[model samples]
Target chain A: MSTVVLLTLTGLGLAALYFLVASGLALVFGLADVLNFAHGLFLSVGAYGTWWASGNLPGAGASGWGFVLAVIFGVVCGTVVAALVELVLIRPLYSRTIEQVLVTVGLSLAGVALLQASWGADPRTYPRPQWTQELTEVAGARVPNDRFLLIGAAVIVLAGLLAFLKFTRIGLVIRAGVEDRSMVTALGIDVRRAFTLVFAIGGAAAALAGALGGVYAGSISPTGGSSLLIFGFIVVVIGGMGSVVGAAYAAVAVGLLQQFVNYTSPGLGDICVVALLAIVLLIRPQGITGKVATS
Target chain B: MLRIEGLSAWHGEAQVLRDVDLFVERGEVVTLCGRNGAGKTTLLRCVMGLHGNQTGAVHLDGDDITARKVHQRARRGLGWVPDDRGAYATLTVAEHLTLPPVVGPAPWSLEQVHEAFPALYTRRASPATKLSGGEQQMLALARVLRMGATVLLCDEPTEGLSPLLVQQVGEILRRAKALGVTVLLVEQNIHFATTVADRHYLLAEGRIVGHFDNTDIHSREADLLAHLGI
Candidate 1:
């Protein structure tokens, strides 16, 4: 009973982090039709930015204010970098799928190399504030205080994203643009600007997730973003390529599956995920909630 | 208030539009009549800045909008309703009705649009893909109206629509004309064109081959039909 409770809670916490990262991936794909492989690069960038920000603070990682500032700065930095990348690199490659794939993949490689050169491939520690270090018993399972905070943050972000999409005119335009780019442009809306904004938002969300996940893991490595990238791709593929809601559901499902498998057959956990993905593809190639291609 | 001078467009290496020159004054309804593959769609695309590989001058309200971007031209009061009745499969009819930012003076409100096309009200919550062909056409026109466009460019507005829907579309175009919206329409339906347009320009093999006013439409109907091979 305790083991189940522990696995469930841990799975849910992992799901929260996955939601933050994968939602952006789904959105960027949905709005821009760009498979941004460098999304993983943004994750590492945020983690490093947070580390630097927290280290610069008065009490370093020990200060609550320092931790908060680091997280905020990390997100902001990610947003700015993503916007620049969109404007300079991705914008010119619109409607060129093969080129986008090549360019973004190359960008990911370059980003990882730059990180290695700058940080010397060391696994650096991320700041965990004192509050997050506290532990409590929840439903007979030992729970880290930060896990609840992560879950809460995930919920808040989801709610905020939903509200933004539902209530705002820009959000409506973005949704419309996602459906028909030419129509949106013919309607006189700047679809390119909308794409840029969506890309930036996706980057910021991934960065925020990376900062939190790094703190949770207690360390961030240069290759840390690569594993999350694979997980992000799995969640998105299982959910749907361009579906934010689908990504959230898939993230939780994958997290739960991984957690349960760890208890049952640890070595086969990765195989189980691949098998499940294969089954989904065999049944619904477009994905669980993806729109069918017209032709 | 829309003019195109020396406009020529190409699709890759094959030239589609051959130096087409046309103009529409404010409150005039002009139709560019042509059969399939006559470059009517390409001409409209050129006007909308969708066809980048083009040599032309498009003047809107005495402004040289030749080099202007699509959205910029749109913001400057150029509204287009393409033949495909451009609507997203995922967006609701209400979203299609409300998403476009209104540009220029005398824009139509959501209520006003719903009033004009009551069929849209029933499908407000439905995705655009779920709407019938006629409803999609109505939504496309409604979208342009909401944008407060001074010059409305419509491509094959009556294409693939039922006769009843065609009549409804004509009514909408007439209403738009009464609102002083200068209409440059690419149409194949002669009866529908005669009903709404003040003048007609016959296009064939990508060039303006004939021009007829409403007064000349009746006498030259047979010639025009023969030219269009109707």
Candidate 2:
């Protein structure tokens, strides 16, 4: 029973990380129609940003409100980078699908290489609050407190994203744009602005995930985001491209399945995930929620 | 209040519109009549800035807007009701009605829109995809009217609608004209066009071939219908 409880909690923590990365990916793809391969780079930027701020920023440290400040800084950095990418790179190649994909793929590779050059290839110990490193007993099992933090953060992000989509004017434009972008523009709304906004939002969320993920794993590396990004892509595909709620559900399924299967056989978890993806594709090609533009 | 002078458009290597010139005065309802591939839809797309392979001058209220973007043209008081109705799958009816910014001075209020379109009012909370075809068409027209478009570029507004719904659409277009909205319509329904439009331009092979008022149309109704292949 304790083993089950521990596995469940751990799986949820992993799910939270996947949700953070996939939600942004879905939104960017849904609204902009740009398959942004550099999304992993955004996550890396966030993780590295938080790590750097904890040591270098005057008011930020590894614990308490200082850690919170560092996370904010990292998110802001990611947001700025995302917005810049949309303005400078993606905007110029609008409506050129192949070109956009190639540019993003090239950017992802170049971004990682740049990071490796600057920070070296070694994994660095991530600075986290002392409390997160400790554990709390739950259901006769010792569960890491970071699991709760990850779950809590994911819940908040999910709620916040839903509210943003539901109640805001930009949200309305985004929803409409996803359905028919040309129609939205015919209504006189500037959809390119919405594109930039989605990129920023996606960046912020991915960065938050990067920061939280480093804490969960106890270390951060330049390639860390790319590694998690593979799962992120799987989660997005399983959830449906552009649906946040779907991402959350798929993340939970993937994470839990991986945790349970990996426990039984050392390296079978990843293969199982691929099998699950194939089964899903064969059964429902549009994904669990269907690709209906952020619904 | 709207004019196009020497407009020419192309799709890659093939030219579609050729030196097209037309105008609609303030509060006038004009119809562009053509057969399939006669560049009617392409003309509307060019005016709305949706098509890029174009050259010539599009003047809205005597201001050259040839280089304006789609949103910019829309913001300049050109409301478009596309043939497809352009309803969103995710947005509700109310959201669709309220999505476009009010660019003109005499835009309809929510109360006015609700009074004008009671079906839309009842289905206000429903997603646009859930609405029937007639309802979607009505919602499309209502959305533009709510935005208070000074010049409406409506393409095939009555296509595929029932006789009853077509009458409703005609009534709405008449109401828009009464409210001082200039309209440039592309329609195959000649009987409906004569009832709502002041004048018509016959387009063939991408150029304006003939112009007629209601009386001229009534005299040459059969010939015009045969020409339009309707």
By DockQ, who's the top model here? 2
What lDDT tens digits, residue by residue, belong to model 1 across residues A158-243? Answer: 87777777678887776676566777887788888888888888888888888888878999987888788888988888888777
TM-score of chain B of 1: 0.98
TM per prediction? 0.90, 0.95
User: Using TM-score as the measure, which candidate wins?
Assistant: 2
What residue runs in model 2 are displaced by over 4 Å at the alpha carbon? Answer: none
Put down candidate 2 lDDT per residue, B30-102, tens digits, no spaces.
Answer: 9999898999999999999999899999999989998888999999999999999998888899999889999
Q: At residue B83, what lDDT does model 1 achieve? A: 85
The clash count of every prediction, one per candidate, is 0, 0
Q: Score the docking of each candidate (DockQ).
A: 0.50, 0.78
Docking class of 1: medium
